[model samples]
Target: MRAVIQRARDAKVTVQGEVVGEIRDGFVILLGVTHDDTIEDAEYLANKIVHLRVFEDENEKMNLSLKDVGGDILSISQFTLYGDTRKGRRPNFMQAARPEQANTLYEQFNNLIKNEGINIATGEFGAMMDVTLTNVGPVTLILDSKEK
Candidate 1:
């Protein structure tokens, strides 16, 4: 499992010109699943992301977690994160998990976040979504469960 986490002032996902998910003052999380990803991976990332202290404190230090700031999450399933660009003109998606497996893990991940008591909005799984966000501080981070 992997994720691209971006702090945002606001974020939303649209599908076929209809808003699917939206949030304010939180994170826009682009999540990806690989063939070997498991529930443990989803759990690890959910715990880490919600508790991550990247938001600013009263003194302007990056010391507040998402919970501290009452932030929301706009979660989106992104299979292309695993696209392999090494030896071909076209990106290879061999490392991405199959749709069924990916969607299962993706839902589990979102449930874990919701269980943490943080409000979470999500893009439709397996859909062509248009996501927009105002990235606060332009702060972005990448996390891979396998790396941890």
Candidate 2:
């Protein structure tokens, strides 16, 4: 499992001109699942993300977690995060999990986040979406379950 976590002032996902998910002052999480990803990976990421201190404190230091700032989350399943360009020009998605597997884990991940008592919005699992966000502090992090 992998994720590109971005701090945002606000974020939204639209499918065919219809808003699917939206959030304010929180994270826009681009999540990806690989063939070997499991529920434990999803749970680990959810916990890590919740505890991450990326927001600023009264001292202007990055000391506040998502919970501390009362932020919402917009999670989007993005299999393309595993697009491998190591070979030819065309990107290969061989490392990405099948749609069914990916969707299952993705939902599990969202559930874990919600269980943590934080509000979470989500994009359509397998739809073409247009996501827009106002990035805050331009803070971003790439997280991989294997790394932990």
Per-model TM-score, in order, reads 0.99, 0.99
Between which residue pairs do clashes occur in model 1? none
lDDT of each: 0.98, 0.98
Candidate 2 per-residue lDDT over residues 1-89, each given as its tens digit: 99999999999999999999999999999999999999999999999999999999999999999999999999999999999999999
lDDT measured at residue 75 in model 1 versus the true structure, 0 to 100: 99
lDDT of 1 by residue, 1-148 (tens): 9999999999999999999999999999999999999999999999999999999999999999999999999999999999999986999999999999999999999999999999999999999999999999989999999998
Q: Which parts of model 1 have CA positions greater than 4 angstroms off?
A: none
- For every model shown, the clashing-pair count is 0, 0
Q: Model 1: what TM-score? A: 0.99
